[model samples]
Target: MVDMDLLLALASHARYRPDQLAVAFEDERLTYRQLERRVSQIVAAFRRLDLAPGDRIGIATYRGVDPVALYLGSQAAGLQPVMLSWTLGPALPEMAEALGVEHLFVGAEAAGLHNLATSGAQVWDVGGHTADIGGFLAQSEAEDERWIVRRDPDQVSSVEFSAGSTGRPKAILRTVRSDVWNAWQRILAYRACEGDRWLCITPMNLSVLSGMVRAVLVLGGSLVLLERFDAARTVAAIRDGVTILPLQTPHWSQILEQPDLGDIAEPRLRTAVAIGQRIPVGLARRITAAFPRADFVVSYGTSESGMITALSATDPAFGTPSCVGRPLPTLEVEVVDEGGRPVPPGVRGDICVRGPSVVAGYDPAVGPIVSSMYDDWFNTGDVGQWDQRGYLYVIDRRSDVFESEGQLVFPGEIQEEVSRLPNVREVAVAGVQLEEECQATVFVVSDRDNPDIASIASIEAAVARVSQVSFRIRSVDRLPRTLGGKLDRVALKRGQW
Candidate 1:
C-alpha cells in the first residue's frame, strides 16, 4: 500500500534536499529547511487553535505566501481545508453548511465580512495571526510537531466546489489519492519538473489552485502567484522566465498579442498551457508564432474531472488549432450516443471518460454527475468525437445544444468557425428563445476598426457552406465573462449584459 501522507512526504523531501529551493516569492526564496520549519510552526499554531486531525477548516484567503502556508499547515495538522472563493463571502454560511465546515481561516480583509454566518464555526484572521511565516519558523521546535495522523488515500483531503454550469455550485469532496494522482498525471503529461516556475494568474478559488498548488509543492517547483490577473504582468512574467505558465484561453490569447513579450529576455521559459475555455484557432496560431520556442498546449477538463484531455505541440493533429489534444496518461476518453454505445469516428456524441483523475462523485450528489458512472466511466456532458487517428475534438456542452429550424446546432461549432475570422479576437455562441424554441445568436470581440457585422457575414457564409445556418447576430462592446474568464453563455441567454 502507498503511504499517502503528503505532509510526511514533504518533510522527507525537505530532509533530503535541504539546500534546494522549495519556494520563491518576488524577492525571497525559501529552502527546504525553511519550508519544514514554517510547516512545523504552522502546525504548532494549529494546535493553539485547538483544531484536531480531520477537523474541517474553511480557507477563504487571498493568493500569495500566506495562502500556501495555510494549505500546507492544514495538511500538516491533518485538517482538510475546504477552499472557498473570496468572491463568495456572502454565501460562506451555505457553503460551510454544504461542506460541514466548523472552523474558518479567513484573511484580514475578511475579518468582519460575512453575508451569512455559520452556526458553530469560529473565524480566525490568518493574516493577523501569522504575518511572516518564515519569522514564525524561527521559534519552531521538534516538539511543535504535535500531530501525525494516519492518512487514508480515500479520506477526503479537500472539499472543492464546482462552478455549477446549470445553477448553484456543487460541493465536491476529494480524496488524497485522487488529488495526488491528478497532480502526477499533470506532471507526467506536461513534463513539469523541479526548479520550473509556475504563475498562478487564474482564479485562486478553483481548478488552477487545485492543480497548481499540489503540483508546485510536491515537485519542488516555484509558484509566483498574482493577487489578480494583469495582462502586462503576465507578459512580463513570461518574458522574464516564468516557465510552465497556465492560463484560460482569453487571458493567454491577449498576452500573445501584446507587443511587450517580444522584448523580454528569459531563456528558461518553455511551455505555456491554456485551459478553462476553448482557445481560438487564430489566437493559438498567433501565440505559437509569438513564442516560437514555447510548447503551446491546450488543456480540456472540468472541476469534476482534472485535465482529462491535453493537446500538445507533438500530437499529429496539433496543426488543427481547434482540436484540444488527445487524452493524457491516466485517462480513457470515449464518445457515446444517447443509447450509451460508442459512436463511430467523426460522429458527434457525449464525451465520456474513465480515469483516476475523475471525481468519484459530488456532495449531495444528484443526477448523472453522481449516478451515471458505468463502473469507472463518467459522462462528461460534452459532445465530441474522436478522429480515425484517435484525436478527441470537443464539440460543445450537451446542455448547450439547441435545435434551430429543425436543424441541430452546436454552439461550439459556430464559435470555432467564427474564432478563425480575421480580427475576430474571441466569440461565444448561445441560443436565444423565440416564440416556440431557441435560435442561435453570436457574440464576438473584434478589432474596433472593423465592424462586427463583417465578422458575422463571414460566419454566415461559412455556416451556409455547411448548410446548417439558422441564427441571428448581435454585437456588444465586450462579452460577459465568468470569474474564471470563460464566456458566460448562461448569463447571455438570460439577457444579462
Candidate 2:
C-alpha cells in the first residue's frame, strides 16, 4: 500500500470510476464525476475569497452534500477544515472565533444561524447547497491545477472536537498522514471493498464519521447518510440495499424494537458494527439475529486512539460488557498499574495504547481533557483488565466510577444487569448527587407502549446482585442523547435525570 491523502485518493477514484456513485444523502446523490466537480467549485470559491494554503476554515452546516464538498475542496486546495458544533446555538460564533477560523460556511438553517450576524469571521448561507455558494460553484470551470495542490504529510488535515461526555470538549488535530492512516485502519477493520456502501448514521462532524467517509470514498465505494439516527429510518435504509450498518449501543435495541423490522428480511447487510458504548449480550444477540447475513461487532476506542479493539459477537469470549476483544493488529495495548508498570493477567489497571493513526497529542491549550494527553503512551483513563486468553475487557472510565460503601462501583455493570431485565427497552446509569448523597440513577425506557415500566423492585434486585450501591431507578420515555446519538452522560449527571 502506498501513502496517499484523501484528496489524492479522490482524484484517482474520479479518474478511473467517473460514473460510480460516490455519496448519497436522502434523495440527493453525487457520482464521482459530479462530486469531483463540486469539490473543484468549492476550491475556486475558497481561492476567490483569497484564502491561502493552511488556512483553517469552519463548517457549521447541517448534514448534506455541502459539508463533504467543503471538506474535500479545502483539503484539495491545501487547507485545514474544522467541523464546528452547530448545536451550540448562540455560543457558536464566539467558539468559532476563539479557534481562529476566519472564513466560515454557515448553513442557512443551522441552529447557530441566529448568532452568525455578529461573528468576526465571514459567513455564507449555503443550507442545502443553496444561496451564493451555489452560484459560485455554478460559475467555476472544471479541470485546472486548482483541482489539486501540494500537501505536506505533517500538515493538519482535519481537526475533530470531542463530544465531551465527561465535562468539556477537546480539539484533536490530526495530520495528513495520520488522517490517511486512520482511514486505512477503518477500511481494514470493516473489510471495506470497492462495492461496499456504508450507511452513516452518525453526525458528519463526529471523528468516526470522518474516517468512515474517507474509507468508503478512498475505495471508490458509496456512502449513504441520514440527517440523524431514527430506528424506523435506519431499519428502512438497511432493507433498501445498504451493505454496511454501524450504530451505537442505545440505537440497536430501538432498531430491534421497530415493529416493521421483523417483517422485512434485510439480507443485504454485510456488516453491523456497534460503537460508542458497550452492547449487552442480549442486545448483541438480538442484533446478530436481526441481520442474519451481517457480522455484528463491538468497536471500542477513544478520539485519542483510532479504534483500539473490536470484538465480534461471534467470538466465544464476547459475553461481558468489558470484553472488547484483543487489540487491533497495528497497535500496542497494555494494562498498567498506578506506578506505570504492566499488570499481570486478570489484573485491572489503567489502559494505555499507542500506535499508527493514534493521535500524536491534543492541542495543549484545550485544557478540558489534558490529563490523558501526556507524552509516550496515551492514558485512556479507562480501567481495564486482560484475561488469561489475551482478551481485553474495559472495566469503566476512571472518572465514571464512584465509591459506594468503600467499594468502587461501575455504572456499566449496573446498566448491563438492568439491560438484561425483560421489557426494559433502553437504560442509562450514572452517579448523581441528590441531597448530599451520591445516588446511582438508572434512567430506563419501557419497550411496550404502556405507562407501566419495568418493576423498580426487580431492577433494584438485579443491580443489588452486581453492586452494593443504592440505585434510584426512574422510568422515562427516552434518554437524552447528543447530536451523535450517544447517551449524553454529562447532561444526565447535571440533574437532567
Candidate 3:
C-alpha cells in the first residue's frame, strides 16, 4: 500500500539534503531546508488562527515561493486547499463563498485586483511589500513545531475547480491516496528523477501543477517556477540546462513563433509534455525540430480522473489523429456505446475509466455533470475510441459533437484541419445553428498583423482539403481561452466573439 503522508517524505528530504536546491523562481531560490521550515511556520500560524482539519483555505496568487509554501502547509495541517484562479476577476468572491472558504491567501501583487473581503473570509497577504507571510513566520518562530496531521487516505485533501467555461465551475475533491498515486504515475510517465530540473510554466491552480511539484520534490528533484509564461524566457531557461519542461499547447505554439528561437543553442531539455489539449501534428513536428534532443509527449486526463494516457515521443502513434496513447498500467480504460456495451476497435463511444486515482466525486455545491459513477466505473463525458492495439483516441467532448445535415460532425476534426494552415495562428471550430440546419464554422486567428483576403482564402482552401463539408471561416484578432489554456468553445458557441 502507498503511504499517503506526503509530508513525511518532504521532511526526510530536508533532513538528508537540506542544502539542495528545491525551488527556483527568477533570481530567488529555496533549499529543501528552507522550504521545510517555511512550511512548518505556516502550519504553526494556521494552528494559531484556530483553523482546523476540513477547513477550506482558498489560495489565489501569482506563482512564487509563498504560494507553494501555503499549499504544502495547508495539506500538512489537514486543511483542504482550494486553488483559485485570477481569471475569475470580480466574481472570485462569489465562488469563494460557494466553496465555503473560511480563510484566503492572496498574493500581494494580486491584492488590488479583487475585493475578496466581501466573501467574509479572513485574508492573509503572501509576499510583496505587505510581507504578511514574513510576519506570520516571525510570530511562529518560537512555537513548537506541529507534526504533520494524518487523516484517512480517502478523505479529501484538496478541492480543484473546473474551468467553468460553460457555467459555474464545479468543485472536485481529491483524496490523499488518489493524489499521491497520480503523482507517481506522472513521475513514471515523464521520466522524472532526483537529478531532473522541472520547469513549471503554468499557474499552481491547475491540478497537474501540484502533481508535478509533488513528484519532483518526492524524488529530490528541483522545480523551476515562473510567475507567467514568456516564450523567450522559457527558451532561455531550457538552454540553461532544465531537463523536464511541461507546457500546455498554447505555450508551445507561442514559443515556436519566437524569432530568437533559432538563435538559441541546442537545449539540455530531455522531456517536454504537452498538457491541457491535444498537440496538433504540425505543431508537434515543429517542436521536435526546434528541440532535437527533447522528447515531445502528449498527455490526456481530466480533473475527475488523474492522467490516464500518455503518448511518449518514441511512440509511433504520438501525432496520430485523436490518439492519446494506451492507458497507464495503473488504470483501466474502456469505450462503450449508449446501451453501456463495449464498442469494437476503432468505434466511437463514451470513455469510461476506473482506478485508484479517480476522484471520489464533486463537492455537493457543484452539481454532478461531467462525471457519473456507475458500477465502480466513472463515465468521463469525453467521447473516444480505441485501436486494435488498445491505444486510446479521444474525439471530443460529447456535448461538442453536433449533427449537421443529418451527418454527425466533430468540431475537433475541423479545428485540427484548420490548425494546419500556415497563415492560421489559432482556430476553434463550432457547429452554429442556422435556420434549417446546423453548420460548422471556423474561427481563425491570423499570423500576420492584418491578413488580406488572399491569406484568408488560402486557409479556407487548406481546411477544405481535409474536410469536404462546407464551413464558414471568420478571422479574429484573438481567441478566448480558459485559465488552463484551453480554447473557450462554450464562449464561441454563444457568439461571444
Candidate 4:
C-alpha cells in the first residue's frame, strides 16, 4: 500500500539522492538532502509553536524555494497551508479571516496587520531564513513525539483561492491523493521524465502548483520559479536547459509577437503546457514553428479540478488547435442541459465533472454559486458539447449567452471566429438592448485602424456562417474584464463605460 503522508516521499528521496538537485531559485540550488533537512527543522520549529492538526496557516510570499519549503513542511506537520497571492494587497487581512487561519507567515515587505496573527500563530521572518538557508537546514533537533497524520486520499492538504472574476474569489481545498494522481497523469501525458527542468510560470498560489511541483519531484526533475512574468527572462531560463514550461496564452502571444523573442531560443525544451485559456490558433502554429524541439499541449482545468482533460502531442485531434481534448483517466465529464439531464453528443450544454480532484464546496458568504451541480457531478460554468468522436468543445458560459434577433449567441463562439481576422487583437461579445427587447452586441479590439463598412460586413458574414441567423455584430474599441482575466459582460450590460 502507498504511504498516506507525502512527506515520507520527500524524506525517502532525500536519503536516496541527497546530492541531486531538488529545487532552484535564480542562482541558488538546493539538493534533495538539503531540502529534507530544512523541512525537518521547519516542521520541528512549527511544532514547538504548539500548532495542532487541522489548523489553517497562511503564507503571504513570492515564488521561491522558501515558500515551497513552508508549504511542504506545513503539510508534513499536519497543518493546512493557505497560500495568498503577492498581489492580494489590502484584501490579505480579509482573506486570512475568511480562510479561518490561526497561524500566518509574511515574507519580505509583504506582511500586513499583525492583529490577525492569533496567539497560536508564530510569524517567522523568511527574510532571515533566506540569508543562511544551509545554516537553517543544518540545525539539529529531536524528532517531535507528536502524532503524525495518516492522510486520507480525500482529505485536503492545501487550499487555493479562485480568481472570482464575476465575483469575489473563494478558497478551493483539494485532496493530496488527487494531487498525486493528477501529477502522475500529467507526467505520463507530457512524457516528462527524470532530469527534466521546468520553468514554473504560473503563480504558486494556483491549484496547479501542487500537481506540477509533485510531478517534477516524482520524476526527479527540477523546477525554476519566476517572481513574475518576463518574456525575455522566461525564454532565457528555457535556453539554459529548462526542459518543460507552463505558459499562459497572453504571455506566449506577447513573446512570439516581440521582435527579440527568437534571440534566446532554447533547444532543450521538449514540451510547453499552455494552460489558463485557449491559445489563439495562429499563435499556437507560430510557437510550434518557432520551437520545433518542443511539443505544445493545450490543457484545460480549474482550481476546483486539477487536470481534468488535456491534448497530447500525438493525438489525431491535437492539430485542431481549438478543442481542449478528451478527459483524463480519473475524470468523468458530461454535457448536461438546464434540467441537469445529460445532453446527447454534438449538442451544447453545461459541462459537469466528477472525479477525485473536484472540490466538495465553496463558501456561501463570498458569493452565489450559480453553476454547482445538484448531484455528485461538479458543474463547470462553461457551456460545451461533445463531438461525435467524444472531443469536448467549449462554447461559452451560460450567463454569457445572450439573444440576438430572437436567437441565442455565445460570446466565445463569436470571439473565436472574430479572432481569426488579422487586425483583431482581442474581442468580447455581449448582448445590449437596442430595442425594447434585448439584442446581441459584439465588442472588437483592433490596432490603430478604424473598421470600415467592408471590414464590418466581413465580420457579419463570419458570424452568419456560424451563429444563429437572427444575431448581429456590433463593433466596439474595448471590452471590460475582471482581474481574474474573464470578460466582464455584466458591467458591459449595465452600460458601464
Candidate 5:
C-alpha cells in the first residue's frame, strides 16, 4: 500500500502548469510556479528557526494566500502545522500547550491586535514586511527543493479543530495517509477539474479551506480568496468567473437576501455546496432559482472524516427534510444501535463510519494523541436513519435531543418546522439551563422590530405540529455565528446570543 506524497503532487503541478493561476488574494495573484517557489522559500525560512522535522508549528492567520503557502511549506518541511485563528484570544495559549506546538506563525491581522499567550511557544509575526516571518526567508537565499524533508506516510500531517456545535473544539490529528486520501476524494466527490476557480471565504483554520486548497492545487485550479464576505463582492466574483462556491447555509441565506440577487445570474457558476448544516427545502428552492446552472449540494461531513454523505437535487429524497443523500464512493457509512450493531432501515440510531480518510484520533491537551475510534469505526455522535430507498436522514446531535413532557424533543425538528414560518429570518431551538432550571426555548431572528405576538403563537403551533412538548419563543436581533461563519448553537445555549 503506497501512500501518495502531496508535496510531490504539488511540485508536479508547478512543473507541468507553471503559468496557470494557483491563488488570488486582493490585488496579488500567484501562478503555480510562483506558489511552489514561495513554499520553498517558506521552507528555507523555517530552517532558520533551527526546527527539525516533525516539530509542531501553529498558523494563526487571517483569510489570505499566505496561509495556503505556509501550509504546503510546513508539509515540505515535515512540520505538523496546527491551525489557529486570531479570534481565539485567551484560549490560544491553552490550545497551543495542549497540541505541543513549538512555534507559531502569527498573521498580520493578529499582530499587536490580540494578546496570544502561546504557552511558552516561540511566536513569529509573519504578517508584514518582505520576508517578515521571523526574517527566515530573507536570512536564506535558497530556492532549491533540497530543503524538503522526506516524512513518513504514517506521521501526523496536520492538526485541525473539530466543527462541533456544542462543545469545546477538539484538535483532530490527521496522518499523511488520511489527508492524501481526503484530498483525492474531494477532487472526485466535487468533480473538480483544471482551471476551475474556487471561491474561498472560509479561513485556513477550518478544514474546508485546507481541503479545498489541496483539491484545487491538485487539479491545477485557482483559489479566489475574499478577506471578508460581502454579498455584493461574492456576486461580483461569481460574475467574473467562479466554478466552485462552498459556504454554510447561513451565508447562502444572506446572499439570497441581496436586493439585486435576482437581477443577475452567473452562468459560469457551476457548483454551490451547502455546508455546516442541512439546507432546508425553502432555501434549496431559492438557490436553484438564483443559480439554475449550479448544482446546490447539501454536504454532511465531520472533522474525523473528510466527506460522508451529500444531498443533490437529482436524488429522490433531495427535498426530504434531514435526507443527506447517499455516502460517496469508497466510504463506508452505517447506522448502528447502542451496542454497535447495524440498525435496520427507518430505525434511528447513531451514525458511524470507517474509511481511509477517517482520522484515527485527536491531539490530546496534555499527554499523547488519544484515539477516538472504536474497533475500526468512528461514531459520528449524530443520530440519523436510512430510508427504504437507501437515503440517509440525519435527525440531530445526540446531546441536542432531550426528553421534555415525557416526549423526546429534537431541536432540529422544532427549528425545522418553525423555519417555515413567515417573517422568521432564522431560528434555533435549544433546551438550555437558565438560573436553576433547564427550559426549552425557541430563539429567532425576525425582520420586525418587535416580537410579534401572533408570530410567537404561530411558532408554538408549528412546534406543536412536530411534538407534544412546549417551548418558549423569543425573537432576537440576530443569531450568533462562529469565526468559521457557522451558527453558534452552544453560544445560544449559554445565552451569549
Candidate 6:
C-alpha cells in the first residue's frame, strides 16, 4: 500500500538526514531539518487560523522555497492547497472564489495586484524583504511530532487549474492517493535516486512541477529552485552539478538559443524531462547535441492525469518522430475511434487513459464538465497512434486536426516536418477554415531576419513531402505562445498571426 501522507515521509527524511540539503535558491540553502521545522511552523500557523479539513488554500507565489513549503504544509494541516499561477492576473479572483478559497498566499511581487483584493479571502504576502505572514509564524513546540492530517485516501488534496490556452481554465482535483502514485511513477520513469539533485525551473503552479518536487523529496533527493527560467543561469547550474532538469518545451527552445550553452560542460546532468507539449524531432536532436551527457525525455500528461506516458532516452522510441513512448507501468492507455472502439496500430484515434494516477473527478462547482470524459477512462482529447512495438505517437489535440480535401491533416505533423528545414528557426501550423473545407497555413520563423523567397520555397518543399493538401506559407519574426509555453492555436486561427 502507498503511504498517503507525503509530509510524514518528508519528516522521516529530516530526522535521518538533518544536515542534508532539502532545497536551494540562489545562494541560500535549507537543510532537511530546517525545511521540516519551517513546514511544522506553517502547519501550526494554519491551525492557529482555525482552518479546517477541506478548507481551500490558494498559493500564487514565485518559484521559491516558501511556496514549496506552504504547499506541503497546507496538505499536512488538512487543507486542500490550490496552485494559482501569477499569470492569471484579473481572472484569479473569480477562480479563487469558484474554488472556495479561504486563504491566499501571494508572492511579494504579485501582492499589490488590484484583483487580489477582490478574491474575497485573507491574503498574505510571501518572500523578498516584505513583511510576510510566514515570517510571523511562531515555531511549533514539537518539531518531530507527526503533524500530518489523516484523511480518507480519496479525499482531495490539491487543486490545479488547467492551462487556459483554449478557453477558461478549469479546476482539476487530485487526491492524496493519485498524488502519491504520480510521484512514484515519475521516480520510476526518471530513475531518481537519493543523491540526485533536481533543478526546478518551471512554475510551481504546473502539475508537473509539484509531481517532480514530490518525487525528489520522497526519494530523499535535493531540489535546486530558480525563481524564473534564465537560460544562461540554468546552463551554469547544470555545470555546477545539477543532475535532473525538468522543463517545458519552450524552455528547451530558449536554452538552445543561448550563445553560452556550449561553454558549459555538465557531467552531473543525467536527465532532462520535457513536459507541457510535444517536441519536434529536430529540436529534440539539438537539445541532445547540446547536453550530450543528459537523457532527453518527453512526457505526456495533463492536470487531471499525472503522467500517462514518457519517452526515456534509453527507450527505443527516444528518437522516433512524435513518439511519447509506451504507457506508464501504472496506467492503461488506448486509442479509440469516434465510436469509442479501439483503433488498430498505425491508425489515429482519441487517446484515453485509466489507472491509479488519474484523478477521481473535478470538484462539484466545476459541475460535471469533465466527468463524462473521466467516467471509466479519461479521454485526453488528443489524437495519437501506437506502433506495432507499442510506442505511442501523439499527433495533436483532437480539435487541432482538420479535414483538408477529405484527408485529416494534423498541423502538429506539418509543423514538425517544416521544423526540419535547415533555415527554419521556429514554426507553427494551423488549419484555416475556407468554403466547405479547411486549408493548412504554415507560419515560419526564419534564421535570417528577412527570409528571402528561396528560403520560403525550401520550407514549402519540406512540408510538401509529408502532406498532399495545398498549404500557404508565411514568415513571421516569432510565434506566439501561451503562458505555459504551448502554441496558442486558437489565437492563430483567429488571425492573430
Which scores greater on TM-score, model 5 or model 6? 5
How do the residues 293-362 of candidate 5 rate in per-residue lDDT, one tens digit apiece? 8887888887788878877777677789888888888689999998989999989999998988887587
Q: Write the per-residue lDDT of candidate 6 for residues 279-349, one digit (tens) a residue.
A: 88888888888888888888888777778888877777777888998888999999999888999999998
List the lowest-lDDT window of 10 residues for candidate 4.
128-137
Alpha-carbon RMSD, each predicted model = 3.2, 2.3, 2.7, 4.0, 2.5, 2.6
Per-residue lDDT of 75 in model 4:
73
Cα misplacement distance, residue 256 of candidate 3 (Å): 1.4
- Write down the TM-score of every candidate: 0.90, 0.93, 0.92, 0.85, 0.93, 0.92
How displaced is residue 244 in candidate 6, in Å? 0.7
lDDT of 2 by residue, 1-497 (tens): 22345666677778888888888888788988888877877788777878888788888775677777787787777777777767666766776676678777877656436667566887776766433463546666654654477776667777775636654766788777667777776776665677798988757455666787688887878888787888898888887878878788888877887887878864588888888677787888888877777887788887777788888877888776668888888788999999899999988999999776777666544444456754658888889999999999888888888875567788888878888888888887777777776777788888766556778899999899988877778888788877777777777876574
Clash counts per candidate, in order, are: 1, 0, 0, 0, 0, 0
Per-residue accuracy of model 4 over 1-497 as CA lDDT, tens digit each: 22233566666677787888887887667898888776777777666767776778877665467877777777777788887664566566667776777766676645554543542444555652455543333444635324346666667677776645554566666666656676766776566888798877546354555566778877777778776677788877877888887777766765665566677644788887777676667667778887777887888876676666888656778656358889888889999888889999878888888876677566454346554745668877888888889898777777677776667777777777877876776666777665577766666667435344227777777677778655555555566754434456667775456
Best by TM-score: 2
**Candidates ranked by TM-score, best first?**
2, 5, 6, 3, 1, 4
lDDT of 1 by residue, 378-495 (tens): 7878888888888888877878887777787777777777776776766777777766777678777776555544555687876565447576767666877766676666787864
The number of residue pairs in model 6 that clash at the backbone is 0
Give the alpha-carbon lDDT of every model: 0.70, 0.76, 0.78, 0.69, 0.77, 0.78
Name the weakest run of 10 consecutive residues (lDDT summed) in model 3: 127-136
Q: lDDT tens string, model 3, 1-497?
A: 33434677678888999998887888778898988887888888888889898899888775566767778888888899888875777877777888889987777545776577887898777754223564656668522335577788798889886545665567788888788888887886787777789988656365666777688888888888777788889988887789998888888989888878888776778898888677788888888888888887788887777788999878987778778899989898989999988999989999999998888788776444544778778888889999988899988888788775566777777778777766677778887766666767878887764364236677678666666667777778878776666677777775565
